[model samples]
Target: MATVTKPEGTIATTRKAEAEGDQLVTMRGIDWQGYLTILDMKTDRRFPRVVFLDGEVSFMSPSPTHEFLNDRLRSFLRAVLSGLGIPFLPLGSTTFRREERRGGVEGGQTYYLVNRGHVRDKKRIDLSVDPPPDLAVEIVVTHPADDTLEVYRRLRVPEVWVCTETELVFLVLDRNGHYARTDSSVALPGISAAEIHSWITRGGYDDEGAWDHDLRRWIAEVLSPRLRETTR
Candidate 1:
């Protein structure tokens, strides 16, 4: 299992499958350059995001339901960050690859919290030079062949949120450099995965405006004081 330490690049595991929509194709023995070519050709940037791992490649197309849930979750997180005065840089569906790890992943939504200050003025992210996003999100309307969490773990992302229609799971990277299921986020304190799941499930927002209003209000009236007292 060769892991990319600096994003140099491809792998050799192969699996194939077909579907009515959002097709998935996995194969091994693909060099880093081959994977790069495949990625370069896709201009539309539609569904079926790609993942590359040690000698294997996976192409996945997410469904509309997946997109809807992904959008809602992304918005919810940004609102929370803004309301709480937590600086963050949202990296939406950015393709991240590292040749050294022999794996790469494009998160449904990714964010740089600890490194937000560094990327504030940048026009784009250069993973070779910069740390990977602290948090990556996945909405599992359809499952992929390669393990998503494993890919992130190779990328060294601090946190991952895996959301199914029924449940949301948080995986935090431990000191030993592996993911462990946790109730609360290590990357974003004062918020738990269950709480987020509940809010999305409740779904009272008439529109984005309403969602923002309510989220900010909740933070200001409820979470703020709690966080302040805890810090004191």
Candidate 2:
């Protein structure tokens, strides 16, 4: 269930469930300046990830399970990319925003793959002049009332991987600038969403090191040859 409140003349909605353990709060009528102020205040503490779409802002506090899933997925991605000999730059939970587009979001785990070299040497990313990450990940334990996909669309991110408790979904930005569900990852060629989901489920209860070793083994013995053939 969700609770709606009016604070300081702004309409705010908060959602919390004991089973989910994730909390989401949404506030309406927040101007760009207000959003920036809130972001600045929370700069030191990265929890309660923030997103702004138009005049509405959402703050999400992820749970232990959510973060565990996020960490495992990130490790899996890194292992796959390293096994494939792909050069990638990992930028974890960086805030991406553009005022002109009136949208912004803090990614859970983002990576620059094909466009790795574009912002490789930069200390910071200015969306005004920089290309958005090639791959962005989102772990959604609780359904967001805000339109997060719209913010990603405005940022022109090439690909997004959304993970829920049950499944992982791959969304690729198409020619028409809309995200379409895809069977395989555009950023990491030959990787399928269903395969990734299976790996996550398999590794969920195992020892971390042992699970990772098995994942690497699969990549080396099974995925590596397939990728090599595609390149050739």
Index of the highest-lDDT prediction: 2
lDDT of each: 0.77, 0.84
**Ten-residue region with minimum lDDT total, candidate 1:** 1-10
Candidate 2 pairs with clashing backbones: none
Model 1 ranges off by over 4 Å: 1-23, 144-146, 204-209
What are the RMSD figures for all models against the true structure? 5.0, 4.4
| lDDT (10s digit) by residue, model 1, range 4-58 | 2223343345565665434567766666777777677777785568887765668
The weakest ten consecutive residues by lDDT in model 2 span: 1-10
lDDT of 2 at 72: 86
